[model samples]
Target: MNMSRRKFCGVGLLAVISPLGFPAFANPSARVRVGVLKFGTVNWELDTIKHHRFDAANGVDVEVVYFAGEDASNVAMLAGDLHVIVSDWLWVSRQRSEGEDLTLAPYSTAVGAIMVRQDAPIHDIPDLVGKKIGVAGGPLDKSWLLIQGLAQRDHKIDLAKEGEIVFGAPPLLSEKALSGELDAVLNFWHFCARLEANGFRRLIGAHEAAEALGASGPVSALGYVFREKWANENPDVAMGFIKASAAAKKLLADSDTEWQRLAPIVRADGRELEVLRDRYREGIPNRPLADEERDAAKLYAILADLGGERLVGKASQMAPGTFWAALKT
Candidate 1:
């Protein structure tokens, strides 16, 4: 983690500076406040947890605050407006370095895949050289870093200069690829799943790439993060949230029929729905982060290589408490 102070405060820095005097969160009995993005697969799990009263049944009262995007959510979390949110551990790690005292829990092992057109000339990672391969998320994106690892391992090529790389929002990547404006796309799993129904071929999954590149075991690409201050004060609520999420995952992982039950959230039907369901099924994690040392190592290594100090910072390893095992039950 080679992140410097200025480079580290790259996004919404003004917001985090004010949390110093933001009134302390004084809830004697925990009324856990969580935040979420407007849409994503995590929403479905959160929904199931709510509809089934998984949180309540676990004796946790939870309030979910939905945000427009990550920036607002990050601001709120740092300001102590929210206790917990699901996100990449990179963000949590950076905040922890800055003294926010955050901790992480698992949310998903499922991740998006790299894909190519059915008739594309590229047959392997090296074939991607000099081709127009679109990527979603910014440079520090997980999928992008995973692919960089693929290149670093097999082809010994720097993908940044090796290909015509287009980075933008996820929808634009799919739209361009579908219109033949790009040769292939590395995109969100949901977007890649939809493309599969249209005859797109999977190249490699983010998690699969990390494992093949020398991770300890299968690892999740996303997880839940919460302020240690809140989690410390109300350990039961924190543990309840974890158990409830695990329960929701078990429900869905054990039954594909549960996908149809979430049709409104899936937002697709027919063959497309089937593809998404199958992709999600394929992504369920077999264990927790504590068990994925190699996977975590690869994640930090890849991010360090691709994103430099901007993402991983100067540390040679993931920050302490990046994965919260204290509440593991």
Candidate 2:
């Protein structure tokens, strides 16, 4: 893949500066450690981070950590071991409330349509009444927002009520739903493609769910999160990461070939790259925070409605002292 001159310069700068020492990550030690999720759709940055033709230029050693969920990343953050966390919106909100020094760095992927078995009775959001739905990543997962968005607008079905929905991991839900153990699976990423290939039906997404709810907005998508303290202590490092990311995004925008290069790294079957790439295209746009706060608020409302408000807390509670604050700089 080709890189612009700016990207090449960024890479060179990272290499030149990495030898200098710092308390958080010392010089002449292991490469600057950065935590990354192990999901197929989420960690696509690794392709650019590791092989951006500028990896050595970034002056930081990238350490990819495969987290089972946001909670795991939180545990790692609390331990002060991981430098960054990347996942869906709800988890980010939840992490913020707990006094974790994390902030959204940049958006990665947009939440997409919910899926069900093709033979399943779930034809639309209204059909989800009394149906068991597969959910991933606990209450803070994007799937929860989709469900609430559906209930609040289309079905008028209250998510707060019991027996309205059943949530579980993709594998378990897929097994149960496919084996007649459940009615529908509300999942994301490779599972959607996998389930669809196995004859699952498309139910709804954050986008479609928003439309159904009489809203016009792109919901908060995936993002790069890191500790405020870490980022503050290493402003150059943080900026370097984002700058390189911007460069990578430019490459992606410039060529499907760039995406083709990144696809195999994140995709398990290499077929879902199209799906993943599409989500990426509609998401962050190589920038940080957007002027709009509605999507983030929508996520909070859904979490509050789902009784996860204690986990998500208020927007005011999410401080401006973190990486999100840095985005402005």
Candidate 3:
């Protein structure tokens, strides 16, 4: 699929950068240590960056560290063992409110959805009443909160009170949904894609739910999170990584061959692979940073009302500097 280069932000320099390979004599000081979840989607972009030497082209060396879980990655980042990690802006907002200097660069706008079996009686949020609904990431999950908010606003119904909500890991919820144990399931984007591949139908996507809640456009739920102090000290290296990331997104957005190359690492094949590839491409953040920030602020207000302080911490509105404006393309 051919796409306009304009869709990708901050990658104009790619035309001038040598595409052959990394420079023979590179600066050793421009190295970035990125911590990633072992099976996270972030690895797909990071892999593309490394496979195509996007980091080298942008005058930086990216060192990837794999973790079993996001909490472990967060621990490594807080311990100064890693310079960057992929996480949501909400967490960044909460951390900043607590005096942490962390900030985020927009990564993906992809979010979860409520999925039900194709033959199931569930057709809408109202249909979920008194039905067993499997929710990944627990009660305070942004996706779950958004669904609750949407349900309250549109139908005058409270899903939490009217439905049987079961919280569990994404994979487990997906399995239960497939086995008919769950009337519906809300899982992460990749898991949702897998469910879709397996003939599950989406009752409502989080993006649509956000729009119903007054979001002007697609808002990125996740980003490349890093310390403000570290970015300030290594401005060039930070900007290089951002640029490399943009270039990688551009490549992935335009190349089916690239997705095929990533088959093994993605651990998917056939219809599942195609669905995952399409969903990932759909998640590429294309709007301007200002637009994203504004929508995120609106979402923060909605999520805060539903999730309360437990999810948002001490921050009232999304803490200032939640979205790293300096990294805006």
TM-score of each predicted structure versus truth: 0.86, 0.73, 0.94
Minimal lDDT window, size 10, model 1: 3-12
Off by over 4 Å in 1: 1-30, 327-329
Q: In terms of TM-score, how similar is model 3 to the real structure?
A: 0.94
Which of candidates 1 and 2 is the stronger one according to lDDT?
1
Largest lDDT belongs to which candidate? 3
> Which window of ten consecutive residues has the lowest lDDT sum in model 3?
1-10
lDDT of each: 0.74, 0.58, 0.87
Q: Which prediction has the highest TM-score against the true structure?
A: 3
Question: Is candidate 1 or 3 superior in TM-score?
Answer: 3
The window of 10 residues in a row where model 2 has the poorest summed lDDT is 285-294
Point out where model 3 deviates above 4 Å: 1-21, 24-26
Per-residue alpha-carbon lDDT of candidate 2 for residues 186-261, written as tens digits (9 for 90 to 100):
6665566566656676777656665454434554566677767666677676655665565556556556777776
